[model samples]
Target: MTNLNPLVIAEIGKMANELIVTYGKYKETKEIEQTERIRIRATLLALTKKIEAETQTFQLFLEKRFEERHRLYDMAEDLMKHGMKEKDPDLINSAITLIKFTYCEDPLKGNSLLKITDTY
Candidate 1:
């Protein structure tokens, strides 16, 4: 997955706010040159396109992450069921370890547990 930069998102938000203020100022001005009006309109259109694209990217990232989490949960459950049916202690232990790894908060700790589970 591509890494999402929070700073970039924040910068876009700041730029949007500035554009909104500029637009409001333009609306309040009594007399504005035709070229200046065109420029402002063009800028607003470009910004709107950029914001829409970024929103879609963020939404897709969220959806993918959600799907991955669900997939992991389902795998763990399947492992647990198979282990119980086979009357195998090792498989049951592996399933419990995977579940613990999934719920682990610390990334480093979780990674280690995941490595262990992956071996099974």
Candidate 2:
């Protein structure tokens, strides 16, 4: 087995697999079970595809949410800096409002009471 070439090894493996599928009862006690197994495998494959699609969608949502959060923070910082330089209380209030609305909004609501302090 160790001395066999890769091609021969692969052929032997294929043959063995064929023999098993042809002869092995596996979990099937009758013809109906064999058909049921095929159906089960098809369902499993569909479920796997659905799960992958859902995971990709979730990742995209997370990335978009993160970008939105960063954009909001950047806007708030710029407004705050401009407000301070011009000594305008209205601009400063706007900045504060932006920060409060962005972070303190808490999308998760009271389900997660972890509040966002004035870190900015």
Candidate 3:
């Protein structure tokens, strides 16, 4: 068997202690990282729920607003009929324009069938 001097034995012990300290530090960092990930995931989930609630509220508002606009369109239609009877072409054209602007299926207005369904 090879002889080991006191200095060599001491050095080996020091290196082993250093490795243990390094491993402890690594474990602590991993635990902290895991905790942070959990917190971030919980925060994201809460935000998603809040967004969904807001989206539902906006959907209801859009429905009510659309109903009101539809009523206004019916009134405009009645006005247009009266104007036609009175031989006022300008009044008829104005009502037609209003209806078009209010009810037109516009891509820019996000009025696509799929978009409306997916949004809610």
What's the TM-score of each model vs. the native? 0.50, 0.62, 0.66
Tens-digit lDDT track for model 3 on 1-120?
899998999999999999999999999999999999999999889879977986787687678767778787997898799889988999898888878877774423443323533332
The predictions' CA RMSDs to the true structure, in order, are 24.2, 15.5, 6.9
Off by over 4 Å in 1: 1-32, 105-120
On lDDT, the candidate that comes out on top is: 3
Whichever of 2 and 3 has more lDDT, that candidate is: 3
TM-score of candidate 1 on Cα atoms, chains taken together: 0.50
- Candidate 2 per-residue lDDT over residues 1-120, each given as its tens digit: 259898998999999998898776653567778799999999889878966986786666667777888899999999999999999999999999999998876544433213434332
The TM-score of predicted model 2 comes to 0.62
Residues forming the 10-long window of minimal summed lDDT in candidate 1: 111-120
After the best TM-score superposition of candidate 2, give how far the Cα of residue 62 lies from its true spot, in angstroms.
Answer: 1.2
Which digits, one per residue and each the tens of the lDDT, describe model 1 over residues 22-52?
9888876735666688989998898789669
Q: Which pairs in model 2 have colliding backbones?
A: none
Q: Considering summed lDDT, which 10 consecutive residues are worst modelled in model 3?
A: 111-120
TM-score of 3: 0.66
